[model samples]
Target: MRRIATAVAAALALGLLLPWAMPATAASAPPAAAAFRQEVPRTILALVDLREEDTIRLSRIHTMVELPLNHLGLSVVYWNVADGLPDLSRYPGLRGVVTWFAGEPFADAAAYIDWVGRAMDRGVRFAVLGQPGVRLERGGRPVPLALANRFFARFGLRDDDGFSDLTYRSKPALADGTIGFERTLSGVLPGYPLFRKTDARVSSHLVMRRADDPASDSHLVVTGPAGGLAAEGYDRYFDAEYNRRQWIVDPFAFFRNAFATDDLPKPDVTTLSGRRIYFSHIDGDGWRNVTEVTPHAAKRVLSADMVRIAAIEPFPDLPVTVAPIVGDLDPTWNGTPQSVEAAKTLFALPQVEPASHTWTHPFQWIFFKDYSRQKEAPFLDRDGTYRPTKSDDHAAETAGEVSDIGRYAVPRAYLQQPFDLDQEIGGALDYFTRLAPAGKRAVLVQWSGDTSPFEDALAAVRKTGGVNMNGGDARFDADFPSITGLPPVGLPVGTERQIYAAGSNENTYTDLWTNRFYGYRNLVNTMRHAGAPIRLKPFNVYYHMYSGQKAASLNALVSVLTAARATELAPVAASIYARIAEGFYTARFEPLEGGRRWRVRDRGALNTLRFDRASATAVDFTRSTGVLGQRHSQGSLYVALDPAVAEPVVALAEIDRADRDPPAPVPYLVEGRWAFSALAGEGTGEGAGFRVAATGYGEGAMVWRVPRPGPWTITAERDGAVLWTGSATADDDGRLALTVPLSGIDPLILRLRPILRPSGGAAG
Candidate 1:
């Protein structure tokens, strides 16, 4: 045994080291061996329409195929086989056909049925698309009864007890022991392929029992109940797209049943190759136009298969031109009753900038063919007489028309012409120049198409002001080339042509990639042509709401708006304006500093000069007079004396201490420990009334003291001379206080002589 093992190891080493040295058969082993073995099935094909019906079916398929078990190693081929016959030859190893036959008008039922039958007989599995009860017919003829019965039996549907009940006659048996009448032959056939790995007995296929009847030999398949096709305990299929009006038997269960019965063998796994094929037929339409059924079916297909599905839409190649102002009325007037309400709705959208394309787009002369007869031409005189033909006369008339539209007719931020015709463009400019306010010139001009002359004309318009060229050259095939002979620096490149393509039939919403790419490209192109003076940005996007009524279009708009908001380039001022209009008050202004020189070190320091009606002098400060035994006014306490004064008295002004009352008075001493004095100048005699000047005084002044609160007299005297005297009291702080009268005292001079003081030493 050792010797034999040594020899085998030596042979293996030789084979690895020198493959060519091995026998000829061994040298070609890899390819020859693979060729002899079967390939595992890894992909399947699904054919659907490009309309809403396909969307519904695809949605349903997506749901089923999305399951982990089904998706593990499978792929799907989604094809819009609207042309009837698919190029099956392209898919060399195509295993089976999953088809929705309801929507198409079949030319010959017998021929098509025969073709399908032959395909099935040739070992190609047929997975009928859609749920049970979905009817289909060729040339308006129902599929043969025998063919239908055979298909039904494959799905475990058979009449028992020879009952003639029509309801049960052609019904498929369900897992819940109930039966439902058949609507189409495929209604009784499996809608999905069964893998070899999936159990045949315990699966839904065996669980659904068929009655013993003459029709038992028929071949049919039904999907499981929990599957999207059937609702709980209900034999009917559930239509996800509609308002649940349609129901049919489960197609998944039927397929599993057929596989288990051995009538349809499991696809040869060894022959399967994991290659996916995608087919789509996209045509421009709104969301509502596509039947709700299409998305439903799509969901199911996507769920059942692990494949990439693409839907291509044939969007219209709209010629680039300034978007026409659909309707316009006088500024003082409201919208016309006949105008679409959508215009108003559009206006309400974010940054829905309005522009005039004349009162009705086409030049007035062209629009009202009989402008001269109707006396509507600008050249017509007030009395309806035609003016003599003259160059300046024509200019004046054109100006009047422009004035009517600019001043009275349209309130839009900009104006547009119907076309870039020389007369129209040049006339619009002249008219606007005449009608525009002395300082305000028309800032923008609009025109249509991508003609070379149009590009040149744009340069001329820009030299005078700004111009917006409509997206006329926006063809899928047209490569947007750079424009030349304009300004030394050009406008943003992409802004040149604003491509307005119709939305996809399946998705009515915005196309993020298309819009972003196209919009950005135009802006970049414009910038490249015109340079920075021209503020280039994608200004508008237009779509028809009635196109397909697709919710996707609305959804796309929302998404685009959201994305625009996220973009830094989006106008910030507009957003702020919107917020302000919503009544969301917020102060973004910083306080203005008047350049005054004042160091406010403390809260009390601020009170000295910061005077308004709320100023309280007594509560803000303490006071001291020039001498003792003299009457002083409480108002004098806040007086700002010259710096020449002995102590340069600052008077507490009204001490504001937190522990005291809200406007607490500052303490002062008068009769006992502290004293205040008033002195008459040299000229003034002791016998006459004496006076001392004090500068600051106000209505809020009051002399306050601590201890016992009582009324007291304050005499203003100097050198035996008396100026004035007043009675006051010490309420909370211990000090004699007086209310100084401001009447007749422009520059008050008074003597403060405290006649009495509180018992607890003069308040300090």
Candidate 2:
């Protein structure tokens, strides 16, 4: 409970400007500000460079951002600034601008210079990603840094100007032997609208000797270590010829270490090394003298100031966040009957949200670059399917790659096909569309290898209502990138291994063991990644098969998820959570006098407006359809938006002031159902009964919500027949403890009544 409150407090702080938001009207207010009230935008512009930096992060900026953009509110129209700048005049309701600059913006210094000048003239907000710009020398002027200085000036930021501050979040403490490094990380400062936690997970990373330009108004949403001990360009610098050196030691090394990825069976005999005993005997606590397993890494308890690791187990009291990405299940990949059944059953649960990874999970971009020159388009197996083939006659082959004769290796030719829009997107969705249990279908498309598609491919996917997600938050440099801004940086062969999202967890799960930590602390990456005047961009984080691929990855993910679920940040499905994100990000708190202001926009979305006083709230309307629902969220009044509508709706001073603010919604207890609390007096009154709307919930499911701490009872009935009744005690802060099945609770007005006692005794 203390942790949840801390998280909420952080989120409610809103933005960098603090208690009061800075006037959207900048020093250079545009002529459009004349119609300021009417012209405030319901949209934001996200200009990205579509490129891949590392083999692990993937390329294609848009692939990973759909969920965040949609869930946050505000429609975004993407543009490649690489060609210079777009005509921003069309974005009348444009609130701010963000860019994943990378190395491109610097290369085209002249074009970006023009764009930055225009942005300043128009009083726009800008955010930046990656390093400000690379240092180019061996010539006349240090001009790249100068241009970066000016570009950031538009957002009230100044580069470090060759001055830098050094800070560390975690130290590389060696373990006694090989438990691995201590597997722990920083926590978050909950409640911040953007960052899930307040811990300087990213901010610490952004700390540089002389890289970032620090601005007072620019708050670091995330901060973490400068880099790991073995970080490239730091402890381990690879020269240009390093690749050639690997070839010499590679062949012999492969045969030397036989079982590196796995372990050999524990030897029955133990040699007395004098220091320790190894008998292959497992301790009662599973702490084997040889092999002991611990609980998930996130929950590992620590004592003596982090000297020891305690094995702990923690379960999800909140809804499970669904990754939805499932692969290796296509029939061609040995999808057996039992495997198919298990897949279906696992996804059928109300909690699991399914996603598509194409029928054959092919490595997208790398394979394309390696073999696109092949006349066959390598692995072009009918565009969507893979068939056995061997066109290469190369003698250098591994047993696995070759046929029965050797089977050691096959010729390195076309291994897998590139992005097949039709087979992968449309056909791949077929299983989900058919298998989805009534009312639900896969909404996200998980990419294979985080390969982003071209405009044509993206259009095809949008036509099917699927959104792409797989690329890292900012590493979009691999897929022949479709850069948005003016300058283009980084050659195709460039590699950036810095973990940009480590502010919340300074150490990777591996780092917890290895004691090597470094990161890119900027989330949204700018004036705190956008305009310093506004709150920071939503601190977004995610992991991939590489962040996991090994068993250690699971520990990393679980630890992170455990932290997220504990806070109010734990949201519903990606779709709904996306709406909430939209509500938060697109929220425009335009302050009027006397605590009167235009709350968050309702442009095809919903928003919650908290007030110090519930005194006679009146609302006006613009393009909004109608108020969908209302309740109390964490002690504040929340208005649910009907995303289906786009017209503006105003909540004037005439809105009702009621005490029936339910603490939270229990939409998770029963999927597809709307559950909220209302003050109950009798059975028939102005404030009576918890309205359980027939939202088409699933079977055998029940949902609920309570406003305040007290004993509560809910009786579900239909027609005149009482179907179900349940009771539970709420905490002081209104914690609904319900225990009942959906025998007949479909859609009914469940009037929650206080038990009446005969004499004054207790009644539950």
Candidate 3:
């Protein structure tokens, strides 16, 4: 995210000299020319200090030049000189260097010129980017401006007064009549060939006046015929001096050029291949109205050629898990079950996945606001009197809200919350972990208000289990609906807000009311660029749920989802459950002759059972020696017997008291034999079926059944010695019935022997 602006500039200037000095074996360079024929290599490397300037626009330029520079095979490097230059030796192939010196109070022109000249003399090219009259310095002392001015005048074509005639005009006319401003081009130098055929369009206005003399053309670089360079349009000529202001240039163009040129070796483009990009909604409280609109607008802007849409999910702890479009379920709402149900019915469709946006989107508490004085205070009072509290109290209150939500919503597992510091994150995690069910994992959604906060929150989220951050251009504001249900009364065109409104109507289920839009297309494209999988959750944009009953809003939601799918932004692919099942069957399970074995080779102890089997029980072979018997009070464990072989089985009863040491064993009588059979050919292929049945058991026990049948092996062997072994076979019907004696062992295991045979052969 950080741009090496100064390095880029210097690299561009010095890149011109690389080919001549290349070694004989260099691939891109021709044989070195004769000494005199060899160009002096006046590489004018320049580094632009963007720390105090419009960094966003500067970065755009960086992206732009990256491709073209590589295409041209020009040597170039753009360093963000604020952090100081890197070791020049690393780039031995580069003949010259340019650096953009950055700091407070600006560098003196004289000192900068001397430094550049010295660098040039040592086979390095250098240029400084700053205001025209700015001074350069070394070791905190002023350097003479005369020397720098003199050197720059040659390349810049400036007059004695230190000004160039170069000027820019707008290619596309603005709505207003004003064509362009006659300003001296400062900051980023535009002479580099990298900008010649850039996609980013930049036009210039006529030059107005010269720096040295008002009437003379000495200081002008490229004066327009009608308007000449003048002080009126110049940035430096203003009454209030702008010291750290930077000239807006195409950064994308700059980097595109830097990379294509021979100056700086091209980076490995493949590094970014197959990487996935994930974008979530982070503006919890702010821009609630625009949330829905934001996603739609993002999809619209990014749904162009060369862009692939990645999967987009809502922040965690909501109602859904990676639906095509997800919406944020704000836990802050104090609505009851009926209210929540009503909201879900109206706002959420079956396809949507609802993610939690923390307990009450606690912006105020996280931002350190006083909430105790309010009647509906987040924190509780000592004597039931609601008084205000700070950090810890607020965190506890938030955690309570999470617990309250879990009582009703069984599917809500992801938690999208805001936290400022490490302690806050730790507190939220601790609270959520306790509140979540035993099998669930917690995911954190970071709420970053600005760049700095976003970076900070990102660092914290990475440390957690399932934390992800969102990215887009939507500005955060609290008053707007989470997603624009309907356009406001009077909104201007061409504004970002209006764009959201226009795109918000694309989906038509619930109105784009939540202000949380998926930017479905954009999310996908970024994800594809990042080489991430295309598994996306529905965009879960939420609001008060009962804010409006307008038909427009409902239609907006439907339209958004429908449009997203239509444009391939949201594909109808396999669900997470389906994919997990596929993985198990295709990768995990192995096919055997008669019946397949459901052996778990995964490193994790826990895994979801995909296919439902008929009569087998998954036994933990690592713990017990013999097959576990079924008990009347609790779920039973046992070895399955082939119903074809076993019949008239009696139920074995084992009684154990909670407080008492043990209970006497009672044998239950078999009522009557019920015939359970399977065809010899049925459920018995390479990957086929099996069944088991227990017909003669007593009436009190719950019916025991196996979900599926596969060869299972249970052994209790130590040091190459077998302690005990028992065998149970699943028939073609996939049924196994067996009864274990409950007399001697309080906890006993009867080993189930693994059967080895062809698809339809003998069993062991």
TM-score on alpha carbons, each prediction? 0.25, 0.46, 0.34
Model 3 residue 303 CA deviation in Å: 29
lDDT of 1 by residue, 341-380 (tens): 3233322222222222322233232222222233343433
TM-score of model 3 (CA atoms): 0.34
Worst 10 residues of 3 by lDDT: 269-278
All candidates: CA RMSD (Å): 36.1, 18.5, 25.3
- The runs of at least 3 residues in candidate 1 whose Cα sits more than 4 Å from the true structure, single-residue gaps closed, are 1-35, 49-72, 79-82, 103-105, 129-136, 147-764
Please provide, for model 3 over 1-764, each residue's C-alpha lDDT reduced to its tens digit, 9 standing for 90 to 100.
Answer: 00111222222332212111113432232223211132212122335456644442233123222222222222234444455544555544444443333344344555444544555455453322223323434345544545534554323333343333342321111111112222234443222210011111222322333233334332211212111111212211122352222223222123222222222211111110011111112122211111122344443221100011111222111122221111222234222232233223322322222222343333322233222233233333344322322242122222222222223221111223222345344444444444343423334443322111223433454466334322222211121211111211111111111001111111121222233332222332322222212111222232222111223433433343343333211111111222221222122221111222222222111111211111223322222111111211112112221112111111122333322111211111111111111211112333332221211111111122232344533332222345444444444333444433221101111223335466644443
Q: Pick the candidate with the highest lDDT.
A: 2
Q: How far off is model 3, as Cα RMSD?
A: 25.3
lDDT (Cα atoms) of all candidates against the true structure: 0.27, 0.31, 0.26
Per-residue alpha-carbon lDDT of candidate 2 for residues 415-455, written as tens digits (9 for 90 to 100) = 34433447656776777656656655655554443233334
Note the clash tally of each candidate.
140, 90, 187
